[model samples]
Each structure stands twice: as C-alpha cells, then as structure tokens.
Target chain A: MNITGLETLVFGVEDLAACRQYLLDYGLHAAADDPNRLLALDGSGVELYPADDASLPSAPNGCQLRLAVMGVADEATLQAIAEELGKDREVHRVDGRLQSVDDAGFAIAFQVSRRQPLPLIGEISNAPGSPIQRVPNQLGVVAGREAIQPRALSHLVYFVPDLAKAERFYVERLGFRVTDRFDGVGPFIQPAGSLEHHTHFLIGAPAFMHGVEHFTFHFGGPTEVIQNGSRFVKAGYQAFWGPGRHIFGSNWFWYFNSPFGCHVEMDADMDLHDNTWRPRLAPLGADASQAFLLRRRDNWMPGPGTPENGDYAN
Target chain B: MPKSPTVPNCHAQPLCHLSELGEGSARGFLPDEDGQDRIFIVCHEGRLHAWRNACPHLAGAPMAWKRDAYLSPDGRQVMCHAHGARFEPDSGLCVHGPCLGQRLESVALHISTSGQVSLADPHLTCSV
Candidate 1:
C-alpha cells in the first residue's frame, strides 16, 4: 500500500459555531464551499459537522473523531488498499473513496492524493562556521511582518485499546514502518509513500478512552511554533503542553486543548528518515520524551527587584 | 503569562454572583499569576456547584479549551477539553473519556441569600 500522510479529518462536534470560530482562530483557512471545513497551506484540512449529523460516522467508542482520510499515491494504491481491507470486513466506495474500519474500529478512507505542492521556503538560521547560511542581513524574526500559517497537515495520534492489533493494522495491512516505540505506550509509524518520521502515533489505553488523542499540522520551524503559539495564547485559547521539542522525531511542538474532544498540536522541524533508519524503544518520561521545557512569562528586563532568573518560570 | 497554578488572593474575594452565572452555564474564577483559572463554578439543575479547574487525567491541566468555557457543547456535563473527559455538573463524577471512573475534585463554596458566592476554604485555592 502506498498510503500517503493525512489528507483531512472529519469531526462531529456539538457546538458547530464555537468549533468553527476556534479553528478560524487557530490559523486555518476556510474552505469556500463549506463553512466548517478549514485548511492548511496545502489543502489538507479538517471538516466539522454536528454530532447528530447522519452523514458523519459515529465514533468507535464515543470520541469526537468521525473519519480520518488518508491520501494514496495512485489509483492502483487505492484499489490495492480496498482489496487488502476487503479481505475480512465490509468496504464501501462512496464518492470515489475507499471507506473501511481499522482493527481499532476507527473510520478511515482513502483517495488519490490531491495535495498541491508548497513552494514556500522554510525558516533558515545563520549559524557560526556553517557552509549554508541565509542571505546577508535577513533578520531572525519580524514581529508583525506576515501572518503565520500552518504549512500542511502533519500527523494524528490515536488511543488504542489493543496496541498490538492497532499496530498490526497499519504496519501489516497499510504498509507502515515502525519508526520508534515507547514501552508501555505504543509506536511511532511512517507510511510507505512519505519520508516524514511518522504520520501516525498510537498510544495504548483502556477501551473507554479509545478515541483520537490529537492531530497536528506542521509549521516552518521552532520560531513558528513559539510565535504562533504565543499569538494563539494571546487570543485566549488554552494551552495544554508544549512549546518544546521532542526527542524521537526531533520535532518542535505546542499542544492546545480543543472542543474536538482531544488536544490539537502545532509542530515543525521534523526529522525525515527512510527504511534505512532502525527503530528504538525507550521508556516514556519527561527526560526521555522532551528535549527541554520552557514556560511562558511576561517579558521583563533586569532591574533592582528583578528575580535572578528574569521572569523565567522553568 | 499565568502565574504558578495556585489561586491568588482568594480571601474575601467574591467569585461571582448568581446573576452573573445563568442556569446551566459555567464560569471560572481566581486566575493564578498565569491568567489561568484556579476554580470553576457551574449552575446545574437549578443548583450551584464549584470544582477545581484542574482535570483528574493530568495534574494542573485546565479543563477549559478556552477562557471560562468549561461545559460540554450541550451544557449538560462539565467537560475537560484536554482529553474530552466529562463529569457530572453536580456530582463531579467523570462519565466518559480518559479519566473514566474518576471524579473531579469539588471545591466548597458559600453562596449567601443575596446570591454572592465565595470560597468556603480559601486556602484550598492557594495550593494548586
């Protein structure tokens, strides 16, 4: 199977208006035809519907994620995926997409890739003694030069009751490779058609907690993660965890609570790898997971009464 | 920037009046240094109840996805948007999500006949 990364996710929400406003404020572009669908720079996006909407699939347990749509590389890959999944379960072809349920019972679909190319240049830094450098006099950051937008849909996470079964579904049936593993947690997986470290990550959990853990989009760099997160915080959205870097994929991340029944993340600067890279297993902890952690605080300058750390909380 | 997760200046502070909180609506109060609420009050089934802003699944995790928005979309269950765990608005018993079989810690409140509500144990708010 030549399944690509995330194409779009459909969310069945309670308050359509509030979720709409939340996505709009989260730096997502509005889809012209639908009031609820929001997109990133490339076309990967999320569509929202009312929880009672008949068109949306009921969540496997009772979580908010209704459908997760992955893009395939070609018509053959789409057909192949259909045949592979059709072996033991019902497969439906609705609106030219293959629809089936994974081993964990989450609704999934596949279609020919429609993601357009993003030609924008990402962030570059001028480091000492580095052969590659930015053009002369390009400042590191501009406070209000341009609006920050997510480049594309990055990855999704799920809380699975049976980690082995869930991992087998993607790794065996869907042609994904395990990039890394977290003991007592789950694995980070990459699809066959993409070089991204992992388009999906699974976390082992109880049956009642079975649902989407989080989904995130890629920004340009750590600057974008922090700056965009700061802007989001300024807009009154609640921040859950992050504005920090992870060790596995080396991606910078910032997570925020959402009405979508799970956390949403903004990430960037992920390490790309091929099958040549081997998977590693490590215990999940603050030290093993995060590279470092930082706290947000009011900007201040050193003064007579200034704390020794100068407003630094961590 | 939010201060430490501790509730600040809870002594003699009136959280909100009954008039400010309509029935079936939730409101949070006493933001710590970080502007994050320390406790939230909900009016459910014609009665008033208060709970710590933190969710049971994760320590110090605020229940709201945004400022003072702590209830589910239907205004029935008090929701922790961090992972969609919901609790009874009156009993604080989690009915769904990651913290299943858990309960949100309740905060005691003193509601006077005049409709003013204050922390019954102000010291509780100052810890976390």
Candidate 2:
C-alpha cells in the first residue's frame, strides 16, 4: 500500500484520433503515432496513453485502470513492497514496473519513479489591480503570453462503489495520508512522497461509474492556466470546468472534457505542505469545499465604456 | 399527472421558491423530460440562468449531490462541483475547468416587471 508516486495514466478512449488531437493541442508532447496505441508526455515524463488498442491491459467494459508508480528509496523499499503485497496479491513485473491490483480492482502499477524536474517559472505575480493579473508586467508591456507547460502529473480521481474499501486499501496499505475528508462521503489522500493535498480522490457511488473521473498536471501560474486553456479551446476541444482556484489544493485549474470519457485538467501554483499540516475532517455538508459556489456565466467581454477600452471579445 | 413540456424543470420536485435562492446562492433544477430527468435551470445572482445541467466532462451532471453546484467566494464564477470546473455567470462560458471555451445551453429568460420568471423562447424545445 505504500505508493511512491504517480507513474502514468492509461485511458480507454473510444476515439483515438480525437483524443490524440486533444492532448496534442492541450500541450502534451506526442510520443507515438499509431491511432489505436498513442502515448503523450508532459515535461515530467508522465505518460498519457490512449488504450484503444486491444493489446493494452484493461478491465471489463465498466471498469477503469489506474497505474500509480511507487518510489522505492532503493531495492529495500521495493523488497518491502514485494514482501507485503506479494503475501496476498500477485505482483508481476512488466516494463520494469511492478504491476498489481488492489482489493478494489484498479489495475495498479509501481516502479522506480520516472519523473524529471519540470522547468517552471517560480513565483509569478502581477502589478496591483492590473489588467494582466497573475502575470508579470514589465514596463507597462505584458510579457508575451506563455504556454502552460505541465510540470508534473498531479493526481487522478475515480468514482467507486465502496468508498470505505477504497479508502482502506489506499490509506492502510499505500502509506497515503488523508489531507481532507468529507465524512461519510470520501477522502482526499496523498502519497507519502508527494506534498500535493491529494494525489488520488475517491468519490462514493453505488456502482463503478463510467471510468476515470479526471486527471491533472501542475502548471506555474494562473496566466498559464488561462492561456493554455484558451489555446486548447480555440483548437476545438470541449472544456468541462475551471480556470478557478480550488480551496483544497489552492491551484488555478482549467479542465477539458476529453474523448476518453473523463476530464483533463491544467493546474498551476498548488499549495504544498508537509506532514505537519493537519488533515481536516469535515462533515459532508452543503458548503464542505468552497465557501460558496457560482453558477456559470458567459460575459467575458467588459461592457461598453469600461476602463481602457479593454474589450477582449472582438 | 403528466408534466408540462414548456414549464421549467428542476431536479427536486416543484421548483425551489425564488426566495430560497439567496443573493448569490444558485440551485440546479432537473425537470422530468420525457421520463428522463434533466438539469434545466440555475437560479443565482438574482437571475435565472438555465442550462442543460450536464457537465461537458463525461456528460456527468455538474453537481455532486443536491444543491452542491459550484459558486466562487466572490459570487462571480459558478463552478462545477464535480471536477472543479468554472463558468462565467452572465455568458455561461466555460471559463475554467474541463469545458474551457465551451458554454452551457443558455436558456433565455423573460422576467416580468412584477418578478415572475419564465422562458424567453417558449417555443424553443429543450433538446440539449
């Protein structure tokens, strides 16, 4: 149960062409060309694969595959995992990655961490009350719109029927810490090696929901989230939510509906904390996450006679 | 009793009283459309903005449970409770989240001076 880190995301997509185009436009570097079997990578070597090929490992029609790579501090850590998990489940080695399934039926994989140091700008900010908020303005000239290069694959979410079993398997076995919880609802748990509020979130359901809920990658700033999101939209992908801040991870996010039956998110500036941060356990109430919620709006352009003639919509 | 097609549909039976939605709080209504329940309107910011409550992400409903749809602290952006997605209040633009640049089906409203609310295009079918 002691997971080292997130390795890669494997998706069972219906339309590989559309999914490939969506990921490419969303800024992922393509690694393969086959329509059925494609791979994409962000800066951190987090591989995004479309599981259209029948060769890939997949569950029955209503199941999902989650591959969480465990960081073995050394051979000892790997041995420890093998000793513990191998006692009950069958642990196989494929492509130098330890592959197994937890009690909850998610195809789990582990390996020596394959993450690289993502080149991301540090501490981006804007002039006070400036139009170019969240980005640095040099001499009244806004810096060129920067493309949001995903730093690292942050997390994955799933809808499961048994929240208790899923929580127990992840928390009791994998050494994940609960950063926050909606009592009787679900828990946001982070891997032992990561400082993100949570690396995996499980939501309760009566049956396994369609597939993966969503996946995200960390960006640098709010501007990156917006610019890259705008770029993805202009390229003709469906956006699902966000470009808003989450109270939990405190990251600015933009999520897009992918052809893979789940959402992909571009995130930036997540608040990182160590074990010292106390986990919050709140009852599943109306206002559990945010202080309040706003309904969707579409008025992006400033009204006529607004300051500086800054109507973004032409 | 058979449900009226033109009447706005909400999730919970008998649309939430206009007074129940505070100045900033919004409620999602799922109308029973031809035996299939559909999310119809969101009452927020003192305005009734209607959309096909399906989240563009996987076509899942945006709210997790009842009245759990997203709202920003400043009351500006309505976020999808499921995936942390956001939408602008006035334009229904998917400003943030998985549905970037996409928009919810905006149901035009006809507000009477006396404060009654109804669909602006009564003839339009709810086909989203």
Candidate 3:
C-alpha cells in the first residue's frame, strides 16, 4: 500500500496532433518510441491514445482519463496492491506493471517510481529590512532564461459519484491517508509513501459526470509557477483559473483549459503532512478557498501625472 | 449610498482617456498602490459601466480569461472565465454559475466633458 506518487497520466483524446502539440507547449518531451505518449522534461510520463483505441480500458464514470498510473516504493507495494485488489476483482499486468480498477471504476496501474530527487534551486527574493536572498544588482527574476519545466506530476483531482465508496477504495485498500476534508464534498488523500498533503483529491459530483476535474504538476516555487503561467498565456492558451494561492494545500496555482476536456495546472509550494498531523474539516466556500489571489497583467507604476510628484496636483 | 474609506478615492486620479478604449470594448486599470487591486470600464452599446475586476466567487479571480476579454462571444454579458458566470453589463449581476445571486462590486466612475474617465470615489473600499 506504500504507493509513491503519480508517474503518468493516460488520456484518450479525440485529436492526437492537437493534444501532442499542446503537451509540447506544456514543456513535456515527446517519446521517440511512441509519438502519442510524452514524458515530462524531467521524465514523468504522459501517454495519449486515440479516443477509439481498443487497448484503452472502459471508463466507469464516463471520465476522459482512461488510466492514472502511479509509482510504488518497491515490488512489495506492487504485490500488496495486486493481492488486495485481487481479493475482489481480477488483476491484470501490462508492460510488467500491475493494473487494477478502483471501486469507482477508475483504472490505476502500479510500478516502481521513475521520479528522481530533484536538486533544489531556491527562488531569490528581496524585502526591506530583511536579508536579501539575491545579491544587490543580481536580478531575482530572469524572464526567458530557461523554459519553465515541470519537475513532476504533483496531483490529480477527480469528481466522483459516491464520495464514500471512492474514499473507501483509496483509503482502506490503497492505504491513503486523509489530510483534510470538507463536509459533503470529499477528502484530500495522500499516499502512505508520500509526504505531500494530497496526491488525490476526490470531489462529489453527479453520477454521470464523474471524471477528472484537473491535474497539476509541481514547479520549483511560486516564481516558476508565475513565469511558466505567463509564458503559457503568451502562447495563446486560455487561462482557466488561478495564478492564485490556495488555502487548502497552500500552493500557488495557475490552471489552464486544455484539449483533454479538463484543466491542466502548474502548482508550487504545497504543504507537507505526516501521520502526526490531524486532518482538518471545514465548510467549503469561496472565502475558504484562497487566502490571496492575483491576475497576470502588466505591471502598474505611478504614471507621469500622479499627485505623488505634485506635477498634476489640482 | 455613502462611500467607504477603504475604497480608494479615484476622483483625483484619472485612469485613461476615453479615446484610448474603442466603443463596445473594455480596458483594465491597476491602482497605484500594490497593483493587486484592479478595475475595468466597459463601453457597451453606447453606455459606459465600470466595476472592480474581481469575481464574486473568488476574490482575486479576474473576469477575463485573456487580457481584456471581459465580454462573452456574443458581447452581451460580462463573463467570469473561471467558471462561466455571466454578469449583466449595466448591473454587474451574476446570471449563472455557482455564484448565482452574487454581484460584482461596481465602482462609481465619472466621465468628464473632455472625454476622460476616472474613479469617482477612490477612497471607497469594497470587501475582497
């Protein structure tokens, strides 16, 4: 039950070429072996197949996400998942990885994690009366120095018909712990092997509308999220929601509309949780969602006629 | 209604000349403060309306999905890009989406004979 993290996301798309181009614009490297599948620049996986691909599994709740592949800490975890899932439904192996469907009918796969520990490059900052993170004359931000790349697949959010059943399958069978919950909504569940607040967040939706709401990738920091999001917007993609800080995971997020029928997000600086941390429960609403939010726009400074300079005082 | 002190008194601070915006289009303005606070004015069908750019559902959620894309394709209502909530151009009332019955904070604007548009009460505050 010690699942590591999300390794890859398999999407069944109507337009292969458009999807491929979108992923390329999103900073994922296309695989030479499979043109439909892509790997994040850091090597996290994203595979896309035609909507009518026979190899794709049937979706239970009519979601576009055909399969969400996760990484296990070791062979023992894969064995445990196989054994636990085998008790009820049949288990299948594809490409040496064990695959099973959750109770809610979402396809999942397990394998050893391809995720590597990324080296940390701290984001520079300066404030009055505070020690500067960047030396004087050293610019903290360098737009377009390097293309913003997602380090790893951070998390995925799903809309489920029955919250209790989905929660039981992941928590009871897959050994995920709930980090937080909202009454009548769902829980933010983290895998046993990961310290992130949540790897999977389930939201209650109508029976026929169960599907992936969105999925996000981790960035180095808020600066990266902002810079990458700006670049993405400049590329002519639609900004769905964000460039704002969330109150739940405390991550800086920027979500955009994608061709995959769901939103794709770039997130950074999420909260970490452990066994000792007790999950908090609260009512969900707009005021409870974000502490601070920002819209990406041109920087505004005092214009030439501002009264600050007494140049245009009436 | 009386103006609140929290809202910046925009009377003295002119944003832009009306000629800078095309008729039936909108432009966003950032106050000289921290730049997070914003307002936008729309010249729709021969009338002008101005409101804070933040959506009612999410405080910092800007109405536009892109720069100055405040109207729906048909150019009828002010649309919130985050969730598809449509607001009336004149009233700023939410006509659809999760934040139904909510309204965008409308800012009082003064249009001078010289064709300049500026905030009427810059000192008035609206809750985030």
Most accurate candidate by DockQ: 1
Best by TM-score: 1
TM-score of each: 0.93, 0.64, 0.70
A263-299 in candidate 2: lDDT tens per residue? 6788777767688988788876534554433223334
Candidate 1 vs candidate 3: which has greater TM-score? 1
Off by over 4 Å in 2: A32-54, A64-72, A126-146, A283-286, A291-314, B1-128
Select the stronger candidate by lDDT from 1 and 3: 1
Candidate 3 residue spans exceeding 4 A from truth: A124-138, A302-314, B1-128
Question: Mind sharing the TM-score for model 1?
Answer: 0.93
- Candidate 3 per-residue C-alpha lDDT over A1-314 given as tens digits, one digit per residue, 9 for 90 to 100: 78988989998876677678877777777778887777765667689888789998888544558999999989888888888999999899999778889877799988888777767665756767777566768877786577777778889998888889999999999999999988789999999999998899999877644777788888878988888887877775567667899888898888875666566888988999989999989888766777887854342455664444332211
Better of 1 and 3 by DockQ: 1
Q: Write the per-residue lDDT of candidate 2 for residues B23-59, one digit (tens) a residue.
A: 6565544433111124445555566676666657546
User: DockQ of each model against the real complex?
Assistant: 0.50, 0.05, 0.08
lDDT of 3 by residue, B66-127 (tens): 45667765677887655456788888888865477899888887788998877676544333
Candidate 3's docking class is: incorrect
Interface RMSD of 1: 4.6
TM-score of 2: 0.64
- How close to the true structure is residue A13 of candidate 2, measured as C-alpha lDDT? 45
**lDDT, residue A160, model 2:** 69
Clashing pairs in 1: B1-B34, B2-B33, B2-B34, B3-B33, B3-B34
DockQ of prediction 2:
0.05
